[model samples]
Target: MGKHSKPSGQSGRTEPASGVRVRPLPVRSAVRLGRPSDIWHKSALSAVVAMAVPALTLFALGRLDLIFYTAAGSLCALYGHGLPYAARARMLLWVVLGMASSVGIALTTASLTTSAELLVVCASLIAAVHKTVFDAARLGPPGNIILTFITASAFFVPQHLGQVPLHVALTLGTGVLAWLVCMAPALLRPQGPERIVVARALDAAAGLLRTEPRADGVRPAGVSDAWHATSAAVHAAWRTLYLVPTPTPAKATARAGLERLLMRAESVLGSMGQEAEEADRLRAWARGLRGGGPLPGVMLSAEQDVEVLGVTGEVSDVRRPAPCHPRGVRPVLARLAPGSPLLPIGARVAAGCVLAGWVSMALGVGHPYWAVVTAASIYQANTTLTWQRALQRTLGSLLGLLLYTALLPLIHVGHLAMIALALACMLGAEAWISRNYWLGSVCITPLALLLAGFGSQLPARVLIADRWIDTVVGAVVGLACCVAVTNRRAADRIEVALERVAAAEAAASRLLAAGPVSGAEGAREVGWARDRLAGCLAELREAVEVASGEWWQRALPDERIDHAQQQGHRALALLVRQVSMPAAVV
Candidate 1:
């Protein structure tokens, strides 16, 4: 095949060299624009599809009020659901719960008191804490500021206590419609193609680690692209997994095994820092020779042919090197087994139970419609992400409210064109403004203004005032909850990650110790080990950062963990170089 060189628009921004014309987006601009191709397209597709059901339902019933509920509820399904375990499911549940709870809280407060400003502030604060703590607060990109509209506006929403149940039921019915529309059609059956892609990723990462860092070979540009593709594939796979029921024992087992193998490969490669300059060049040359195609020959052992590149006509016999093993490595090598333990059913059950509780409580409260929003925000694979999201929600909402208050009066409420303009702004909010929390808030302000317009047309300034007050309340409350509900201790999480690293390093050591073997099994073994080690190293770094942050609250033995992690990093780097090119003879 022919070679094509192009930049992969990946995350981590890098400066363009002097001659390079490609200009990267500034972090701030990127965050503000919020890559329409990434978050927006995914979310808007869900939202637009979901809107169909409600629009049709309202068309049949001739009740525009119901459409509002439908529109609100359906928005729930437009979030990031296809992420790894706990993240999608948990966040969705939180959004639903948060929406429901905020509705009730806002309504109750509104009904009991005449202080509209106070109620808005109180509601915003409560929503913020609820979002922050439980991870269920799903107010969307601009955060809980939308809740200001839901709550403070409840004062004038024209409803009796008796109508609460029916209105809530209507809203939830729409929400369910939204949920079905979001998930039912697009999902893959059995396993997604992404899974196959993930498997391939495991193979690619392994290849990089096993090769000695050499300067002789032309670096395969594809290597960077391949690694990125793998990461995206893994992320996609995990997201899809969370959306569905937990995998069966067989599937889960297979996945676990693959995960372990990949981990081992990562660890081994990580042990090696940058190799000698000549070796690096040689490796890069080899990569260039192999470019635009599958691996040349069965698998090249690290030692065989120092010549990196070869003519296209002669693909076979590229270079076959002997495998490398570490000293006294048998015990560690044995651990690189294929097979994963089945995921616990109890975890699934717990997740479901938590989801259900939040849903029920949200619906039971006065402003139950807000439940959808709450349920969506709270679920996360790690509590750290959940906390960050919570803070974002609180801060974003406050910002949105302030913006709304200032801008509302500038727009005319009576003009239908203005309403249309507001809707357009909302779509823009949904389309952009996802990169950073505060930036998204700008879009959210107009969206809320539009949503509120659905019910009544008060003076822009008055509506703005109410919005700011409600946002304040929800943000405060959501943040408070974040502090209250904490799980998955950071220290413990770090320790577990270290343990995994240790296990991977040990296995790679053993593999290196074993003399080189020819044929398929030997190749497979080496490939698997390489993959596992690389993953382990990456995860270790992630775990360290997470643990460090949480250690502040829980007080972990930071010094010990830090020292161990640093040692692991050094050892892993060395190991990578040593194992890059396998030797033929023991």
Candidate 2:
């Protein structure tokens, strides 16, 4: 792989590629079972607790009609579990407010008009907004689906002008409770999120260490994947640790211990050879991070502390403020620019939601909002993922219909029974959805149906028939829009990503040419350069994966991409060597 020009005379495969290959439609991978999130119980437990208290209270008061509003608030608990306490608190605040605002808008719109066409347009636009904002913010997992679901459902509910505030108030109030529930764990273990992230870095580094070294002076098949995964984990650990405030000594000490563990993991990653003992030690320390008893004391001497190469200056200082990267409102506004790639996704969501809802309504489906949700849920970063979601959603929605039918007997027993049953479904949805959307959908579909029957109970036949129709219509229409809407900017993003990697690599090269770095200041600069290049390479990989499946996009410069990645990683390896083995000449 040459940098200036591709293999001109010859055209053939030579080296292993690092980016995730985009298959047309990965049906098996989409439907396949996978490991759950490491902290699945956090979201699962919080969602149940958040719902049960309010739902049971409403049930006792004969106010089950307001269950939807409280449920909307309660679902906010499902987010921010992976963030540090400081970050999580801020994130959850915005999420709760966003959820309430979404529902409030829906309620307001429904109160103003009975026009289905108008409602469809409003819902689609809101879905687009939710999708766009959530992606720009990079709030992981469940994405905008929950917001979409609650908002769309609200639009169809019978609303009067006066009642909107009360309903929205219920949502905001329960959302407050949810915020508390999620933040409670921080009190028990203030360093919980930081510890978990470090543990993850350790595990990822250990996995990389366990990879057998290649002897042919050529890249191995899975080595790049392992390398990128390890790199991402290590960087994520650093970012999370940087976000944690260390105002007190105890907090500072906990932060320091986690930093040492992370440094060890990063060192292991920088060392390209297999070290079985080192890998075992990392895993041991990772396991020790399970509970909040004590930090894993991976001590570093004063001399070793200066070995903080490949770190940002702010990160080099324990008391420094969070990184200066764009966050909160600024980056989100920038991402919402007209020419942004997210615009196409927003376009897809808007088109799909409207079309799905319209078609469902034309068919006289009982609840067309379900179809709207199906459309909103399927739009992923690329069309390949969108197709997969369509399939998984279809399968799960159908299975969930069956589950709902079985539970109908018990649910009809009383309002209390229905409330209990709905809570169970909520629990299962959060727990299982972490592994695969469809598995969770099996539980989720029923929960939605039960919630729909809240104010006025719909018959089993009507509920089943309505949801089935919506699911099929939504999947077909949404997938059609995904493929039809052209995303011409996908390839362009890859190009920009490539340029970033090139610039970062150039800076790193300049640092490498400065001979062996010494002193805290010089080493810190080297570390920052390394981190910049590593982050750029990671972005390039993401851009490649995203562009791979886009329709009607410019042909990707595969050779150029491969060359950049290979050369960039080669530079990184040398940079790591310079940092880790200062005595060895590159």
Candidate 3:
């Protein structure tokens, strides 16, 4: 469904040597959005609880003027949803610190210069840097976009040099509280995140199995997409388990069970051509994992007879002694260089924010940062995704404005009531954000309006009017930027990615061709090759998908991508079999 078919020679493209026509598989559109997954619910809950703590505390203390700062700090909780407890702790710590730094900088800049133009320039630069760091680190959801929104919006908040320290402290203090809230769930279920990851992998594998095959035994369309997703989930599950700082006895046992499940999933993929009942078994196991029940045994007697290799524990132990080096600023700056693929995206974001902010101020909007945030929200990996975001943001904001108008008079009755309503909207926004950006935007719009009006008590009508105006201005400006700043290097990136994948596949194929290895050094080499091939395949998939979505891009190397992916999956399956039965290959 994501791809389209057109006659191969329609655009002056040569036909293949077989003398048969082939269709170029171009992406249908870049605007594909999916429903909310299970993890999204957890993220929404964490955000709500985290924000409520500081929000209600400040409200009780009659310090409602500081709610914006607290809300800004609470945003730190929205990150690291997929990480293990130990890894999550480290990520959240960095996120909270980063949020505090951004807030401080914004407030300081506002105090130093009353010029809106200067503020826009500063915010734009910060947004670019924030986007760079977030992309480099691959810090998942509530990603750089939301962080940029919070910091950029802070630029418009009136600030004084005397009050800067107090506000920064408030943000830092509440940020710590938010961090605690996000991590607190780990105590209740230490292995919960890992379990979720394995469960998702199992579910994805089952989905692949359920796809009907064509007469030639090839899987149905979109099977590649499903396989890609399943592979990612499996890889993430292993990484999460291995990265656990210190696993308790129970967690260790759980980890062992998950390892077995992973092996079973790989076996299913290896035996995809056969009509096996393992698909149902995998689905049942997934359900059991999600439901926290005892896992059922594999029904494939012959497959089960294959030794469950001690691969998981050994790999983790061998890797544990390695020192962890934090990524340095040099690499991040290098990524932001003019020649980098992401450079164009970051540049567009900066330009859009600056121009949108200028337009908002020129139009005398009360909150120009609203326009900046909206502009930031509309950017995605490609122009098509950006277009989708703009539409979703505009629609969501309009509906959100309606909801805000209806509830504003009621909320104004008391400060506590307004705070409560804001919290509720924030919770809803997080809940719906994963389902659809527009749905999430509806909640975010009102919540933002409420928070913006908290200390100032701007009239609801005025707030609504300004928001509508800003939304249009930001969306228009952002879309214009998308059209103007095209990623000219998208096709070139796909070719580079294909070369990397080819190299990785060749290395892996050589390892398999050599048969089972003896000695630690040989085994390590094999394992490294397998891991490298897997990572390269994932990168290729992402690169192609993104490039395919760009407007006015050259035809993608669809056949090359498909062939590399198929070879990569086959190599992985062979590696899995070899690990289980070391002598089988030879």
Candidate 4:
């Protein structure tokens, strides 16, 4: 995609033994709109309320100038929406800490120093750390953008040593509030998050079942996408259920019921019985799960229920399912270890952010943090995804400027008007961002402009012009850094992923060879193998897809990877069938 990209050999010829095939940027899907999340309102409402409470408090005290600090905490509500309440609680607390820490760092830096150059350096490095840590922790959407924005802006915001503690305390307080707002839903429906995901799994599995089976009963080849979606959704649903901590007897009972529903859903997805009819049943169950309704039940004995949860009650006293900690700190730490792809991305972020911020400062834009944030937001999983963000951010910023221009008059009417408008845009960004980043960006741009209005007294035209210039500068510089920081290790990651697939396939094949055995225990063993192989294949596919987009990576064995995936899936299907028909085998 750039000057740094290594040329593959002649077209239609074998690549050099050391070379991997680079994937072209998929521009179409990058900008394409996707279906909105089923529970998007959870986030939209959380953000609006989170922001509104603090805004109102500030307005009453005539301390709206402190809104910038509070905005950092309010945005914390945006993460962990999809996590199980048990896991969400831990993740939200970390998010709260991360938000405060990020703000504190920026505020401290600004107070300790007055050099714009030094601030740019400090903010750039912080942006890199934010990018790396958040990606590593898997703290989902809004991702590091909001955190980076708050930190970068805090760096530029005028701060004095005396008031540093006050600002950080304000942010810390609001972060606690954001955490409360996010966890409030758990009080009403303890398993609401788990139920929603299970229903999504049912819906996705139903899509897979909607296709007609072949005469020989094999799945049609073209329905792989549906199969993949179903498998991923089911996998996620199972994980969510597993993550539900049963601290109390009541919570354990709720989890047990959820496990039954998920098993039924899984069985329906894997069944060979009337596809259309099974699909309808799955959809019916899914609809029933949408509210505080009774869990759709399946006919399973107490022993069978225990088995399906991957536990052997006979050995429950001696052996138990391994515990998964709510705070997933291990993976977070691993992502920063030597040879991680995220490290190189962090390098790109540091370099790009510094360059972008420097250019903006040289250009005399009052808020170079905008440029730093623009750069930070553009670095996604791969260059293709990064390119998409750049396009989205630029276009969104332009359209957002137009939006801000239109709303400028109302914003000028009074403080109440400005506050109301900012709240609406905050709500809109969360509502639309899930569908597509750019759509959210349109609302985000104006929201940003208004936040500036709260912080400084810059004229609307200067804010508009400076934002436009900084955006263009940031996007261009960020892309350059992406090209410059080529990750050759991407190919290595794909190779490792392929090895995992081979290992999983071999394990599943050995289990399938054991023949279908009697009882839930045997069935559970086979089911475990099936899930493992499916997961490995999913990872392999992701690794390949990400590597393909890189300009520099070792040559991929395309035919070998395809064969591995095909064999892996075949093994998975056999395991699934054997586990589903667990009775009467050798």
Candidate 5:
């Protein structure tokens, strides 16, 4: 057969002459905005309460000079939103310590260096390190950028060597308080975060089901997009449940129930006829979980019950043992070595920050660190995201400035009153942030201004003018760096990830084909392969997303990657089925 012609035995279309299976070009949506998330209220409430503790304490003590450090520490409360309690506890502890360490470093460095140039360099390096470490660990949103912002901003605060210990103490103290405030919700609702994960999965599954062809046989516009999204959500839910660290009997039971619910959702995906009813049931269960009420039991049909039973049996029998991975300094140090994907991001961030700082200083901005922070905040995993962020930051800052101007007269009433207004803005910013970056910025801009004026009163006009100028400067400098410093390896990384997925899927496929061995050793191998395949798929998806966002890059192997993923998932499903039926495997 000719290269472009289908082979005689093949049932599908032939590959192209060049051996590329090109897909239709992706259409760019005019509306590239995100919807409001349900967790916004929780996140906003957490920030307000966490910030309030430090602000109220400092206000009562009349130590406004130390308020910034305390507030900086309080920001630590914003992390680990969807993590299980055990995981969240560990994460929050690290965050608080990390926040304190950043403050300590800032204070010590500021004391040693009076030169603005040297301080800017130190801050840039710190920002780079923060970016690298946070990315490596996958700490999620309100991520290392905020930590860098707080630390870099601290460097600009006038500090005496004698005051270092006190400032550090304030940061540590408030950090501890913030940790406590974040953990407080666990007392009332121990499984809230985990339930949220399940709820999200259910909602996503419902969305996927809704995209199925109607009874009249009409197809929807974005059914393929919806399927991909739902797949991601289901996988996320499984991963979340897997990592839950359920040490107690009650927690373990809850975890198992969540697993069953997820399995049912998956089965619903496979059998499209009952999509709406199943979707509604899943949503109802999700709502019950969120409301802290009795879970509405989903009555499965006989076949579904059998499927659920088999899945549960498999889960109990061959759940993979968690692997021992390097922790702490080891993982962080590993990322700094040559060829780490995170290294490029770190380099870009450092360059952007240093250039922004220098430019801000040249412009004689009163707070150059603000410009530096703005620049640091704009660097996402790829240039496209960076472009979006720069736009969001600028637009948000502008609106925020307007809000600041309107609130300035009211804020000028008293220091305590300003603190109250700042708190309100903090609440608003957090509430709106998940909806859209710009909306969040509207509150963040005014909140930041209020925070800066904490210890001393500044002329509102000058403050506003400087912020506006610095914002534009930072946005321009940041976007320039993104264009100049590209992650050329992003596409290559996706290729490598695809290879890993292929390997993993092959291993699992071999196990499924080989019939179950009698010993634990075989089960362990099968489990490991399954876990590795899942991880690789997740990594591949992330890499593809990042690569697709790069401008002026080579055309990505989108069809190839998609084909591999689909095959891998099918192999995984087969492996899962074999696990369910040990006799068939044997």
Candidate 6:
């Protein structure tokens, strides 16, 4: 039952008002929506669009020479789309390092021997280790995994050691070209738009809370959906922040605003659980209150506090509404101001780089594919999840190799159909694997099999042996590095976030006790408290996830800790609303 359990919320209903004029509503659904980003599209285009060029280059080199490294280079387009330029620059450097290492290892292994079985086993072990360790490093998705698969079998290619530098140089060059394609023209500015987007999201959550169904009814479908949707968006914003080259003023504000919005959203979610029966019926009626227009007003102050977020579109000058609070309570809702405690950008990037570099040294020193896996393994908003990802990578790599061996003969090595199938699988894997790593691994194994065939004529048995070997080696070395490098400040971050939540709650209490409040300033303060709490919660979630996976994590009072923090958050939300009514009506 818990598996199907849904969080409670205000029911969608509307109370009949006497003497009110009823008008026929429009047939269209009314809901606020933000413009979408094209990061994925851009990244994909940057890589695959250049497919023709890679083939041509290989042709020019006088060998249908399997554009193996070209595939590795294709991933470079996604490297720095969301980061500050400096961070992106740094990441690019690391990507190159990782790629070089992967290709180097595969080439070395391939050239070192002609035994098909030995090569297969070796490649599989290295592939496993590559997957495991890179995940532990926290490098993240569209990461080095692709590169690893490509290079792990580069060993089977007939190229001599003398050709290693040339091969690596070409791959890196292609990746750089992919990177340039995305950076050439920046169309939509994210920072300013993001600020408005987050603000709107916060506003929507508050409005939903204010009109939630009463205690005796089912939650409004849309409001409940929004809760999950917003949570995901908040997470995405953090990831986007990680990708950006620099923190623009607008983005910084947006980031801060997002943190506050999350806090408010959580408070609203809690309130929905406590609404009375009257509220529930009202929620149901109101759920159908359709109008093709902007959101309902929840007045707050901070609109003119700073200059307009200069953006391309016609900027709206609407003032923010004050945050709504429940009657008869005085929680510190206003204290949840947005702050810098959300994303541990520096720590994540630094640790990720180190993990990547180490994996590169180990895998890169011999075969570059292992280094690629290391890059994929190390990325996560939470370091602990990074470790889990590493585990998944190892498991998937071993399985992938096995699957590849089984299907090898059916595909007919060096055939156009096999290559096409491989590319198709790669595309599908990237698209669907987002659901989970293992599912993606299933497809990736087959793709790798085809790619290996592109450069050599090894039979099914030999291919199977070498693939498994690379996986094991890569997984082992990667995890070891995780133990060596610890995210020392993870615990402290959780502690500090809890403290901030407490502080925000306290502040909201002080403001509400004073009496009725109104105007944008009041709303801003309330919104701020709500957002900060959300951020604290996010941090807490990350910490818990990390602690669970971290092999070296010591004992932590997780149960007691999370319980007390939630209690504080609930109290803050209720008290802020209770105390604001008197001053708010004025």
Ranking of predictions according to lDDT: 2, 4, 5, 3, 6, 1
lDDT by residue for model 4 (1-586), tens: 1112222221222257745544554456666787787888899899899999999999999999999988888989988989888788898898889889988888888989999999988999999998999888777787888888989999988888889888888888998999999999988987788889989988987877776476677766546676667777877787677677776656666676666666655654455644676678778878888866887556543434445544543322111233322335776787679999788899999999999999999999988989999999999877767888898889889999999998888988988999899889988887888889988999999998888898777789999999999999999999889988988777678788888899989988788777765566665565567567766777787777677667555667778887897888678766665544312111
- C-alpha RMSD values across all candidates: 14.0, 5.2, 5.2, 4.4, 6.6, 14.3
Query: Ten residues in a row with the worst lDDT in model 2?
Result: 1-10
Q: What digit string (tens of lDDT, one per residue) describes model 2 on residues 1-586?
A: 1222211232222223543333345566777787888898889899889999999999889888789899999999999999999999999999999999999999999999999878988999999999999998888987899999999989988899999999999999999999999999977887788888989998998888877485555555666667778888887887788788877766666676787677677776568666788788888888888755565555443323554312432233452222445656898888777778888999999999999999998999868888899999999987876888899999999999999999989988988898888888988887788788899999999998888888756678988998999999999999999988978787778888899999989988898888877666666666677678888888888777677665444557888898899878888777766756312111
Q: How high is the CA lDDT of each candidate model?
A: 0.44, 0.81, 0.74, 0.78, 0.74, 0.48
- Please give the range of 10 consecutive residues that has the lowest summed lDDT in model 4: 1-10
lDDT of 6 at 103: 75
Candidate 6 weakest lDDT stretch, 10 residues: 1-10
lDDT of 5 at 165: 92
Model 5 spans > 4 angstroms off: 1-33, 213-219, 272-274, 296-337, 512-530, 573-586
**Model 3 lDDT per residue over 107-177, tens place:** 99998888988998889888877876787677777789777888997887889899999999988988898
Model 4 regions lying over 4 Å from their true place: 1-26, 212-221, 272-274, 300-306, 309-327, 519-524, 581-586
lDDT of 6 by residue, 481-547 (tens): 5455555455555566567666666766666666544444554565455445555555455555444
Candidate 5 weakest lDDT stretch, 10 residues = 1-10
Query: For model 6, how big is the CA root-mean-square deviation?
Result: 14.3
Worst 10 residues of 3 by lDDT: 317-326
TM-score of 4: 0.91
- Report the lDDT tens digits of candidate 5 across residue range 262-317: 65555444443425665677778778778887544454433333333333333232
